[model samples]
Target: MEKCNCRSILCTQMTSSGPHILPAVSSNSDSNLQKRYRCSLVEVIDVGVRYPPEWRKTLIMLLYAVLSTLLSSLVVVLVNNWVPAQEIVSPLPDLFPRSFGSSAWAFQLSEFCSFLLLTLWLIQWFLLRYKSIVGRRFFFILGTLHLYRTLTTYVTVLPVPSQYIICENKVSGGWEVILKQTFKLMSNGGFFLRRSPTFCGDYMYSGQAATLILTYMFIKTYSPDIFWVYQLFCWLLSVTGVVSIMFTHTHYTLDVIAAYFVTTRIFWWYHTLTNNQDIVVWKGICHGQETGNDAHG
Candidate 1:
């Protein structure tokens, strides 16, 4: 009878332990199943995720900046060697013509002060607002100003007035003389004609062209003098342009159009050809969706 009772107690203990052991095993199996399936599902969805458009724009912007800097440098180097040190005459006609009314130094000082103040104010205002569209407009305006300055230089040198002739000969001496002779020789309207080139025309054109080409190549190639001067001019013009666009309420409308089509196209082409696609892809993934992919590609 005692043996039978002991067997019943043993059976009861075994039954209780069986329930606990089965639950623990099932719980472990469920956890393992979840760990295995979770990552696989995540990988499938993540692989299909597309890059955002803004990231692409940012990539393009970065490429533009790098290319432009390199080209500007190249231009400075060429300009330092090729461009003559002589000061060229200003192109603007004197609306308030007066002899000895105001000293050149005083006039220059006044102009400088005025421009400095205006630029400072404009920059302050821009920073206060900090809008991307505003920035774009500024860059566009800056490019236009550069274009104007370049064209004006050409115009001023091209039409040599009779009064401006310092010597008995039609050609003024110096580099200008060489340029005039060449132009005269070329003006005969033939594949190759006999004409003297003037410094004002030929030299100016050649220098400008060389600088433009160099700047287009890489900004780093240029000397510090050329790079800084050109960069300053560009920056001021950009600020002015942005202010005008914002005040006139023309934000991205014209600014983006001009930047993409006219200003940044050269840089864009350079980056498109040179950038690495695989690196760009990996970078884009690491930097999040907002980071651009175009720069790497």
Candidate 2:
């Protein structure tokens, strides 16, 4: 009888405490859910909170761009020196006549449009609340485009389309010549301050057309909600730059055609691959939580 009485008392105690225990667990779960919801909101509103600058990757891309540009310029110089001007064959029966009205102003106009696109992208980054992530992507794409240009130009040598175009003279020394030519082109500041040195045999694809088109692609993909008028202006600028490049006769028709094809293809391919990544993992949304777990593990 004493044992039975003990069993009854223990059962009563457990039944009484059940309500309190259950409520504690239920409240804790609700609190966790609320915290997670607020975190999601912050991620969406603050891009920097979700995406760090990733300076290492940016630096790598910048270095790649510089190297590829130098390599392309080096190839131009070597080709110019190695082949006699008369021996270099122009692509025969050129599309729309090789005698296009070449003008210095046309080249300058194309460069001016490219410069404007660059300025607008910067303004968007600094003043208009665009993320640097987009800018990083732009530079990366540009570097890739230039790398492709380097390979193409190296493989196939095309004569300068216009006789009026001045090719840089052969010079002694290897690295020194590359550096000098690259410096001269860079110092020209996209033909803003001075005429860009005409590098012969860079005719498989048009870099100006590629850059202008790339700018348009970035603006269209990232900032579709931006002012419609500004968007229209960008479209107009790209068209004008492309047409202007053609009139200069620095490149054959195939060069511009290949540029459009290659640039757009690479851009779309890059985004399509990257966008498939898991959003939370790719952006490091749980980095702090992971660190805390490791510390307290």
Instruction: State the C-alpha lDDT per candidate.
Output: 0.33, 0.69
Give candidate 2's error at residue 134 in angstroms: 1.4
Quote each prediction's TM-score.
Answer: 0.25, 0.70
**Which candidate tops TM-score?**
2
- Which pairs in model 2 have colliding backbones? none
Worst 10 residues of 2 by lDDT: 1-10
Best by lDDT: 2
Q: lDDT per residue, candidate 2, 240-285, as tens digits?
A: 9888888877778788999999999999988976786775465575
Return the TM-score for candidate 2, rounded to 2 decimals. Answer: 0.70
> Residue-wise lDDT of candidate 1 within 29-125, one digit each (tens)?
4554433321111122345644333444444554554344333323322232333323453322322222212222332232343344345435543
CA error at residue 164 for candidate 2, angstroms: 2.1
